[model samples]
Target: MALNLNDLQIFVQAVDSGGFAAAARRLGMPKSTISKRVAALEADLETRLLHRTSRSFMLTDPGRDFYEHALAALIEAEAAESAVRQRHAEPSGIVRITASVPAAQFFLSDHLPSLAVAYPKLTLQLHATDRFVDLVQEGFDIAVRNHFAPLPDSELLQRQVSIDEVILVAAPSYLEKHGFPADPRDLKNHAGLLVSQTAKAWRLHHVDQGTISVSPHCRFIADETLVLLRAAASGLGIACLPETGCKAAMEHGQIVRVLPGWTAGTVATSILTTHRRGQLPGVRAVVEFLAKGFQAERAATGNVLEPLRETTEARS
Candidate 1:
């Protein structure tokens, strides 16, 4: 294989920018040069790095696996240059981060932009997905997840970002038409709108360790929280949704919580990352900033909604 420093750099740039032409623009290089370099690198490895098609460009399985390391190498190299230029100043380099969909909408959408405005020299690469990805293996300096636990690998670490709240609600109008259930079992008569791609019985927990299962067989299930929230807001039926996802509708009083006595667990939001190599200027900077930003966000959230508002049922 003929993979070299330049080839790796080209691959890293393409992944970060999401396309060859875009990477070329970011690096201020000719598109043809970028393509030639990437093609050569793929040829050297005798494996396709990317699955390029007319309307889209995506990393192949090998490409996705190789991307993480390439990203780390490029970041370290840039950090070196930035350090030499600064002399005695702080570290400055590109920091790439990833987050789940809800986390991105509720937290990053605002915070990342503010951070960019504050640090003009800092280049931010943020990607949003609901699926979890390996932070170290994927070359991302930071990955925010809603349900994360400590990884056994000592090289990696995680810190709590926030405690998300999950609440059950239905449109006020719908409740009026179909009398609200006084007990959890009473919901059998009403149509339920569950969230997910497949049908699963909804579960609820009581403070007394007693659990109740509710199945809205005539339920409408959506894959996205946003879709679920809108459906519930329109009085589709009852749904157990995350507080972070339904905060807006609740604020407007379009949907009201039912069986406030029950509780649901949202797991916990966390930032997954590797501890650091001697001096990973870029990754370290992003990690520090993220820790501080999430701490502030968690503090603000506590005031907006009580953390232990209710117990939640875990969905499969």
Candidate 2:
């Protein structure tokens, strides 16, 4: 049966405050109004909850029983409200996040130690996979997606956190053995460590010559970037890689940048959330931390990471 919570509250308050007159003062209402609401509550329940005389009142058998349950219900309801408020106010609890394996390895896992230090009460569960999963059904708090083009329409909130310039790279041994390519078209002669996500033709962009598409002789192909990076480092072939992903290898002299003036493309990383507003503090904290961490990493590497912006979900 449906019960009016307001009436239940009023009835409880009227009884606890000793009388309608006292409850009226506490609630800042007329005594008659309080009496009428309490009476209405009893009428709805079809039970006499109070026996009253000129100046005194007492609870009947059913009244005592109802009062106990009503008081407990009110306490639990208030506690539920308080719990939500508290959770919203503080960054705590577990945040389940998902991202591509390379992103999780290079972009995300590194910042976790500091994030834990900052938010000691919060825990993050990382799920690394290449396939896209439904954030709501999968119970993910946030997702990191890297794309070369605009993402498809989604109900989830999308905020771009970082942008990496895609660059061509190869082990120094490979370049020394095969000679460096002076032109984008020359890549067709050199072996290629291709990424499965890209088309057969590698489309590169140059400032003056514009975009050039080269169908290199692929020696190895993999969907995961980490594998391609390793293959390129081993001098298997020249591979296209994000500047950020290959930064360490370049510094360590394991690989060198190829076609210095040309870029393969640009890939942007974005965070997706189920709801932009009223999110749990832990979820919001993770999102902000990831955004800042990516931006800071790009800054240190001299790459321009674009500022965060909310995306509009396109509808068909």
Candidate 3:
């Protein structure tokens, strides 16, 4: 008897999701139905694939080997379907995107409405998180990320969107109490709210003075950029954040740039997608939209760190 693709797909989903219930929820099917189908698949194969338990399950040796091949097969099947769909002129399908929380909140979300208007038939599923998700494993179509270091080596295709300037900021009341630093070295005397994922030392560059690295004494540390922004706004400590993330706060007077003339550093923003998946219309449209949007934003904002020298020299 021929192997059933439907049953194989269900088995893969169950394993990938970590349990039958999760697979059911993801697939929008009943848990019992999923379990039955997988069980039927095992029966047809005449081999036990999973070691079941009340609370969890584990794959048997044979199951692991089978899973490897099954996953590849499923990917091929999807590629085949996508290839056929791409032949159509209009872009219409679900495009799953993953991005860091700050990027999603400050940058991507604001531009999504425009994407919807441009591609009416396209559906978008956004996963906002700081964790680096596996694009192939998670079945995501594209990922948007901001990083100071080179992206880890991968087969995924990456397009550089923009170089976002990082700036130091604090609330008005905090600045009033602690007094503004006269120089980059003075930042050590003030409280610091640090983004834990970034480099411990803040490296600021001046065209004439070259680069100076300062390691601020952190009063608080968090993985999320938004949390660091909020901490800075509440006067907990000064924080280093992307200009885009703090633009609204600066505009609203909730936070002010601490070292106006000096910048921490620039982080690269890139959009990543698998080579095969990038060929799909829906995925291609989103990538183009985001790349253009970032360019427009950079043009409008100018170089936020450029005017700092005048302001700093005036204070001197």
Candidate 4:
């Protein structure tokens, strides 16, 4: 007997959705029909794939391996169908994207309207949180991340879309009271609002002076970059903030860049996806749209932290 693709797809869905009943609900099929199809799939393979009891259904060892390969095959099959359909019709599908809250707010939110206008048929689901999500397991089609170092090893493919310079910043009132740092070393004497995820020591680099590392006396420590930026703006302390995040505040004179000649570090912002999903038209469209938007924003904000060669007087 030939193995049925529908049976394989049903089996994979059952495993993914956690139970036969759930899969049936998702597929809009009766529970008995779904169970019978999966059983037929196992019979065709001459092995029991799932160990099912009255209360539980568990994958046998062979089932575990089969589920992995079957899931990939189903994804490829769907992509193949999508590609053919897209060749004849418009790109129309849900693309789930995950990113940190600030990235979602500052980088993605404003550009979504343009995407909606361009791809009227397409739908987007955005998951905004600071926590790192497992793209495949979480059913996310793409992820946007900011990293100062190389991303950890993973099967997911990454494409760098933008570079963000991290610079020292402080509110005008705070700088007025605490004084501006003449050199990177002077930062130690100031109260710092630190992002706890950063290195224990702040590593500031200069074009001619090399690198200087300092552990600041932190007034507050937070895991979110946006929180640190807020702390600095509230005059709680100095913060090493991304140039993009602090741009508007600086323009309004709410915050001022200190030590323009030095930078905390450069972080690369990238989009990540599985090799198979990245090839889908819907996913590809979103990625290109985001890449271009970020590039345009960077161009418009040219030379965010260019050194001011001469020390400018602090805000009054």
Pick the lDDT winner: 2
lDDT against the true structure, per candidate, is 0.72, 0.85, 0.84, 0.82
Q: Candidate 3, residues 1-316: lDDT per residue as tens digits?
A: 8888888899999999999999999999999999999898889889999998998699999999999999999899999888787756587899999998878988998998889888999999999987889999989999988888877777788887778788889999998999999888998888888767365678887667788989888789898888888999998878988898888888999999987768877876778888889888889889888888887777777853322111111100
* Candidate numbers sorted by lDDT from highest down: 2, 3, 4, 1
Q: lDDT by residue for model 2 over 1-316, one digit each (tens)?
A: 6777777888888888889889999999899999999888888889999998788888999999999998898899899998688666869889888897878878887888889889999988889987878888888888888887887886878888788999999999999999999999999999988876366678899989999899888799898888999999999999989999998899999999999979988988888888643267888888888888988888898877556676656210
Rank by TM-score (best first): 2, 4, 3, 1
Of 2 and 3, the candidate ahead on lDDT is 2
TM-score attained by model 4: 0.66
Q: Which stretches of candidate 3 lie over 4 Å from their true place?
A: 1-88, 197-200, 304-316
Task: State which candidate, 1 or 4, has the greater lDDT.
Answer: 4
**TM-score to true structure, per model:** 0.61, 0.72, 0.66, 0.66
Estimate the lDDT of model 3. 0.84
Pick out the ten consecutive residues of candidate 2 with the lowest summed lDDT: 307-316
Q: Which portions of model 2 show Cα errors greater than 4 Å?
A: 1-20, 23-88, 276-278, 312-316
Q: How far is candidate 3 from the true structure (C-alpha RMSD, Å)?
A: 17.4
Score candidate 1 by lDDT: 0.72
Please provide, for model 1 over 1-316, each residue's C-alpha lDDT reduced to its tens digit, 9 standing for 90 to 100. Answer: 4357787887788888988889999999998899998988888788898988768899889988889878888788888888676544554677778888877877788788877776677788999998757666778877777762433434446565566656678999999998787877887777878765565666778777588887764668786777878898998888878766676688899999887767555556666666553136656566566667766655755623333221112110
lDDT of 3 at 31: 99
Q: Indicate the residue-level lDDT of 230 in model 4.
A: 80
Q: How far in Å is the alpha carbon of 304 misplaced in model 3?
A: 9.8
